[model samples]
Target chain A: AQSVTQLDSQVPVFEEAPVELRCNYSSSVSVYLFWYVQYPNQGLQLLLKYLSGSTLVESINGFEAEFNKSQTSFHLRKPSVHISDTAEYFCAVTLYNQGGKLIFGQGTELSVKP
Target chain B: DVKVTQSSRYLVKRTGEKVFLECVQDMDHENMFWYRQDPGLGLRLIYFSYDVKMKEKGDIPEGYSVSREKKERFSLILESASTNQTSMYLCASSLTGTLNTEAFFGQGTRLTVV
Candidate 1:
């Protein structure tokens, strides 16, 4: 079985400040990792994903996450955040053979204050 | 762009009532998933369908059932609604055979059990 753990329940940062959300996973087999962002009253949107290429993956919105196999971590980072970036982020993992069932973390609420 | 649509944005139902939530994706993806999102728990998978008439249980599948009679439609059914089952329901779809492919989600349906 695979599970994901998001270390931070909430992270508050001022506008233009950098932010990082920690995520760790436990999987016995090789897995695929993903980051998703959910705004208020909306569903989740894909942020980035790490499949089999370089360890680091980036999203178009200036967000990046690196897949560290040794540490079993895929932490998300943004150089700067805006008030509009305030949302909930979730990290998910699925086994390489699993069809499409993703195990998600507890989520980290990012509040970007103006 | 892929589009996933949920039946409702907000729903109010009494305890013990039968509830059904519908989802439709226009991308013709072979995989569809149902998940429930809570405040702190993030998104927990309830069930998923790989193809029409083929359903599989996910992490949390108690008290919930799903039906996929058509290729583009998936429905989540609550045999008997309970207070604990009240949460934001999300539907997502993705192409088959690609573990790294992104899943597109609907706007979500928020259900409140009274």
Candidate 2:
């Protein structure tokens, strides 16, 4: 069985400050990694993903994550965040087989204050 | 761009009532999923369908059922709604392949059981 663990439950940062949300996963075989974000009262949206090749994947909103195979971690980071970036972020992993099932981490709430 | 659409943005139902949550995807995706999001719990999979009439139970399928009579539509059903089942429900669809695939999510349905 695959599982995801988000180290931080909540992270508070000021506007324009850098932030990182830690995520770790446990899987026996090859897995696909993804980061999804949800704003207030909104559905989850894909932030970025690491399927193959590049270990570092980035989103258009300045958010990036590095897939460390040795550590089984894919931490999301942003050099600077805006108030609009305040949201709940979830890390997920799925196997490399068809009909793959996604296992998600306990989301980290990023609260950006002015 | 792939589009996943949930029938309701918000729903209120009484306890023991039968609730149906419909999801339709514009793309011809072979995989469809139902997930529930709760505070601190992230997203928990309720059910998934890889093809028409082929459903699989996810981690939290206790009080939920699903139907996939067509390729583009997936429906989640609550036989008897309970207060604990009140949460944000999300629908997602993805390609059948394991590699280079990403799930597209709907806007979600907020269900409140009173």
Candidate 3:
């Protein structure tokens, strides 16, 4: 069975500080990776995804994740986070032909203090 | 953008009461999911429907049931609400075939079982 693991349960960082949310997955076959974010008083949204082709995937809000096949990791990173970036991040994976069922990690809460 | 809407943002129910959480997606997505979000558990899927009248059990579906009479709507039912079932319930929708398609989520419903 496939599973996801997020390294940090909570990360407190100052504004403009760089942040990294580590994620690791266990799967024998190829899979799609995703990062979803839930801001305060808001719904969850897709931050980025890794399907194929490139090893790196980026979201519009300056967040990027690199797919490391050998390490089975897809960690999300932001060079300079803002106060508005405080949110809960979830790492998820779906099998290639599994019809879009996602297996999620334990989540990481990122708190950016101003 | 896809819009996934849940029936309630907050609900309080007594123990042994029957509870229902409703979800609707405007994008006519083929897949709709119900997930329960806890502090350290991220989001655990309770049930998912791929098409009308088709439902599948997810990771934590033991205490829940689902209904999908139409393509855009999915409902999660708790036969008997309990204190342990109090959590944030989230609904999500997505397309089926495309491997890179992302799931869009609704603002969660915070259910409190008293």
Candidate 4:
């Protein structure tokens, strides 16, 4: 069985500050990693994904994540976060051949204060 | 952009009522999923469909049933709603392939069973 672990349950950061949300997974097989964001009342949206090719994957909204195979980690980072970035983020994983059975972490609540 | 539309944004139902939650994806995705979102628990899969009339039980499918009469629409049903099932429900759609494609999600439906 595969599982995802998000290190932080909640992180409070000031506006324009750098932020890193740590995530680690336990899986013996190769897996695809994803970062999803859920706004106040919206559903979870894909922020970034690491399928193959580069170990680093980035979302257009200035968020990026790196896949560390040896460490079994895929941490999301942002150079500077805005107040609008305050939301709950989830880390998820799906096996290579499993289609889309995503196993998710407990989620991290990132609060950006202006 | 992939548009995954959930039928309802919020719903309040009495316990023991038959509840139906609907989802539709416009991207002709081969896979659609239903997940329950609770605080601290992240998202747990309830059911998923790979094709029309084909379904599979997910992590927590005990009290949920799904219907996929069409490729673009997936429905989640609760034969008898319970207070424990009162939480946010999410729907997602993804293409089926070996590359492990990313999923697109709807804006979520918040269901409260009293």
**Which candidate leads the pack in DockQ?**
4
Model 4 alpha-carbon miss at residue B14, Å: 0.7
Q: Residue A53 deviation, candidate 1, in Å? A: 1.3
- Residues B69-114, model 1: lDDT tens digits: 9999999999999999989999999887744577899999999999
Ranking by DockQ: 4, 1, 3, 2
Q: Candidate 1: deviation at residue A24, Å? A: 0.6
Residue B66 displacement in candidate 1 (angstroms)? 0.8
Per-candidate local distance difference test: 0.92, 0.92, 0.92, 0.94
Query: Per-residue CA lDDT of candidate 3, range A1-114, in tens?
Result: 899999999999999999999999999889999999999877888899999999999999999999999999999999999999999999999987555578999999999998
CAPRI quality level assigned to candidate 4 from its DockQ score: medium
Error of 3 at A113 (Å): 1.4
Interface RMSD of each: 1.7, 1.7, 1.6, 1.0
User: How much is B83 displaced in model 2, in angstroms?
Assistant: 1.1
Q: Give me the displacement of residue B94 in model 2, in angstroms.
A: 0.5
Candidate that beats the other on TM-score, 2 or 4, i.e. the better one: 4
Worst 10 residues of 4 chain A by lDDT: A94-103
Q: After best superposition, candidate 2 residue A77: deviation in angstroms? A: 0.8
In model 2, the clashing pairs are none
Local accuracy of candidate 2 as per-residue lDDT tens digits, A36-111: 9989888788899988898999999899999999999999999999999999999999888644367899999999
TM for candidate 2 is: 0.97
